[model samples]
Target chain A: MGEAIVVTSGKGGVGKTTTSANIGTALALLGKKVCLVDTDIGLRNLDVVMGLENRIIYDICDVAEGRCRLNQALVKDKRFDELYMLPAAQTKDKNAISPEQVRDIVLELKKEYEYVIIDCPAGIEQGFKNAIAGADRAIVVTTPEHASVRDADRIIGLLEGSHVESPKLVVNRIRPNMVKSGDMLDIEDVIQVLNIDLIGIVPDDEHVIKAANNGEPTVMNPDSGAAIAYRNIARRILGDTVPLMPLNQKKGAFTRFKKFLGIGG
Target chain B: MTVKSNHVTIKGIKDGLVFLLDDQCEFSELLNELRYKLEHSHQNILTGPIMHVDVKLGMRNISEEQKTLILDTLKQKGNLLIRSVETQGCVPEDEAGSSLHTLCGLVRSGQVLRHEGNLLFLGDVNPGGQIICSGDVIVVGALRGMAHAGADGNEFAIIAASYMAPTQLRIAEIISRPPDEWENRESSMEFAFLRGGTMQIDKINNVGKVRPDFNVFKGV
Candidate 1:
């Protein structure tokens, strides 16, 4: 009954890991049993980002290769009781596990958890293929840049090719001032290039970098710009109708009047 | 021909044995040497090892007569597979560095297609996908990726697309980004080419009159 969603972006360094960690954390805070699976294999960072790297005695390869039980490799997070992480192996190659193996593991995880969020690796190779094998939905994270937008378009096309219904988009690290000055791609431009349903837009905040470096996800920082956006996105995922927060106070007069009306702000 | 040289040399490869023929040797000499080696060294080359022997005729402008002669000789000896016959220096005059290539599917992200002649794409060139050709490029569908026509410094190459909202475009040495007010852009069959010193995009409203630089299916 649980939904397994794969967080993927064709291009690297576009916040797939950040989105995965934050969204997983937000869902767990909402009282849902969540498990984040890192399928990046040789370059695993989801455990480090979730601050659960030290608790890993066994990893995904160990469970897939029959060396340990699935529950034994599931690392419980210190912050949330309902949250768990299935860390990837650092020493093994990407070809160590197959798509069928990942599908079987995710299927087993789905039986116990309400949300199984998979962190897919970059590129459309074997690792990306294995990560999305058993997912019921997809979330494509991208930056408001030309390369990232194009990559998001391709990933959306690929997800649709695999019959994943309408992958959602999360435009990450968007600088409002630059977008205002026409120096960078705006949210509208990113959406136009990708042509997917917009779910969230995380601003380019330096606190995100600090939180990630401290082995903490940005969603835990309530004062951070990305945190509010991620929380709103989580609320939306829970089927709540929440309006997006404005980037700055440069709204039109009509929009400002609507914001004061208590209907949406 | 009474050949007096060992023109065929067989080496052990991971998949099979590769028989390399010297390019300077005559076709009749190489064929005679290959037949002699296959008939005499059957026990030493193909007896116990579960392997196939492949002939590598390198850089020689082999004719149809020479290819059939080699295939017939190999078949009369044993059940052998011809791995490849690579002619390094024998590309045809028209096909050398100037032949049209048609890519028939969606060009995915991180995929690059580079050709020396014109390119005819039959699908969507998604973002992050690049197509660099030395001649003109014609896309039958959306062109949202980066495309560089006339990559070999031919400034007269034109790029035509059904949906021409490309990430970046380069014709010869000039590059241009799409205008910012392109949000309301429609599918009007646009084409890009160099005018004066800058790249200019124009709609293909009149298809009857051909431009001075435009030519179809003509290359070296």
Candidate 2:
């Protein structure tokens, strides 16, 4: 059976959906058939991040309510032939469907796809319960902040109760400059608090926002630092032992001087 | 199958059935719904000669008057045997139900763990999580959450951990804290217990150094 992994973070705006879109895209590019399920319900944005919102004729709610066939709700990705997206309903609240209903939909998707990526909503309410109910594994996304790490620890606890594979953490929005200056929490600080296996460490890059605005995943840009980090994460998820990305890439004094002179940075 | 009500949710627990009261519903509506469920929808499990049900209030700070309103409603209904009423923050008296509970994993934020007896945790307790027990509390790993060792007012209860930097610690009715300078003592293992009606902390290595009068063990 295919693995159904939920990308969840207890705190909002920690890049749960962004990580879902990019990782799903990266896995699809690796020749794996991936289906991204946006379970955020009313706050659906995975479709937009994947640039497939306009193409969503049917959604997860429609499939759960038997308003459409599961195949009809699967929206094909424009960029990857093997990738598909199951968009969540924009109008329906989290309570529109139960956890059992979501579990059934994910089980069905597991038959045809190698990976069923669920984009979970924030908070540990009914929405979170539904998203995790059908997940075989979990990817908890967090940033290098006290509040975010605290929330991530809670999410990890919840995931552990569900008996999924120990949830791997993805520390998003890391600024090397801030870590060098001792202004932000480093990977060690986050790992110390969470005490879980680390999967990826994505540096803060403006390319992620630009790609999202264009309805494309940052992983599509091969040269972006964030893209390389995400690609490594995708490989790690596929049972490949990949070393973590070095966030502290120190710039030489000559290179810094050249950048100050407006030369190629 | 049991009834599913918006005001109250019922599920079969180990001790008995648990009635969860949703805080969002109107108080009157909640009472009406609770009465209706007990009368009509309890046919499936309530068919037994004797039944015990525990009521769980939602995870919110409830007032005294509200607690009485719920208790009065359940008292009036003689059909189901009301076992106990579990509030959100109040630790139950029977925390010593299990002689000892050994949890092999970390306790995360927003999770409340209560035991009737001693609690032996094998992992860390992150901030925002709580462990309340009527007996002693022990953690093999770091203890950084709220721990109430004497929830049932047992003054002799002690809380021990490898690295104790708890956000809040309590023994019996007293809340004592060591100096902030003691935090981050990685290699030191410490235990906190009540002595002369005041909580005192001592390192495991220096147990014999404590005052002889304070070393007296109380009867369980």
Candidate 3:
């Protein structure tokens, strides 16, 4: 059977949905059959992030409650033939579906898909439990802020207690300039606090928001730094040893020329 | 003339009366002698105002039932009050209930590691993580979280860490200042202890000086 990975962060507003959408799309682009499951229930946003909100006929609740078949509830991605999303129910609360039901649904999807990515909801509540119930592995998403890192540590402890094998960490929204200026926490600081294996680091890019506004994930754009980071994470998940992308961008030619003339660096 | 064995002796002290019970005699014989002394021989002393009686059992270990029997026998006398019953050569109650517990893992945020006695942690205690111990807390790694040593109010307990930056430190009931007050970046190992009801931080090397008994190891 294929492996199921859950994307979770204990705190809210830490880019769990965005990372899930991008990772799922990247895996599909890498010639793998990927199924993205949105376990947020009433607060579903993965469908909108994947640009599949308009095509959701039946949701995860319907499938769990036996109102429809699993395939019927899945919304196929418009861009990639190998990518499909099982949207969450917008009307039902997180308690509408149990962990066992989510596990069964994920097991059924694992038989057909090569990779099943579950987009977990924020907070260590019923939604988070349901998301990680059937996951073989887990990806803990966090920013470099103190609150996010603290919450990520809490989530890592819970995931380990649940026996999810050494969940990898993905530090999102890193600003290299702020880090250099000593205003924000650097990648090394976050890693030292969380004390987990780093899977990827996505630099803060304006294109992530711009692409999300257009109902497309940032991974669809090849030039964005966030896109490259997500692709590297997908490749790492596939057992590829890709080097970490450099966060510091090289100076422009004019700046270099100015620095050569002893004006500015 | 017959030689009488003195199984119990009563002494007059400044505060009250001291009862020196012979440890080498049989418990029943000692009880009988104590009863006879208090009822007949020492009846004149017991006729006055309430006198505090201190029972000193030297080199004798007795169970709770036997101690209660002594207390009851003392209570039978009208003007006698039992002050303290002390035994020699036995560990104190607080020390007897404590032990050393070793833990090797990350104590992450929202996770609490509570132990009844001393705790020896070999991993980092991240922000929001906590360690509540009754005896002492010793960390071989970074201590960035809250650690409450002497959770049961043993003020002599201490907290030691290699990297001694912590959000908060508590010894007994006294809480440390906020993180801003003692934001130490010192590379040396440090420990926290309570002195005169106030928490103090010092280098770990001086622990033996602060608490002489802290050096449990003998010579090399």
Top of the candidates by DockQ: 3
Q: Locate the minimum summed-lDDT window of 10 residues in model 1 chain A.
A: A188-197
Residue-wise C-alpha lDDT for candidate 2, range B1-220, written one tens digit per residue:
3435567778887767788887555777777887777667757676655568888764334668877887777666555688887654322334423367787677788888888778888988888888888788989988888889978888767788998988888988998666687665666889887788988888865543432212333111
User: How far in Å is the alpha carbon of A155 misplaced in model 1?
Assistant: 2.5
lDDT of each: 0.83, 0.85, 0.90
Tens-digit lDDT track of model 3 for B43-91: 5788889999999886456889999999999899888888899766233
Of the two candidates 1 and 2, the one with more favorable TM-score, higher being better, is 2
How many Å off is the CA of A217 in candidate 1? 2.1
**Model 3: clashing residue pairs?**
none
For each candidate in turn, the TM-score is: 0.62, 0.72, 0.79
Q: Please, what are the lDDT tens digits per residue for candidate 1 over residues B176-200?
A: 8988765468768988877787887
- TM-score chain B for all models: 0.51, 0.48, 0.55
Best by TM-score: 3
Q: lDDT for model 1, on a 0 to 1 scale?
A: 0.83
Task: Give DockQ for candidates 1 onward, in order.
Answer: 0.22, 0.52, 0.63
Residue-wise lDDT of candidate 1 within A7-111, one digit each (tens)?
Answer: 999999999999999999999999999999999999999998888888999999999999999999999998999999999999997899999999999999999
Docking class of 1: incorrect
Model 3 per-residue lDDT at B10 = 87
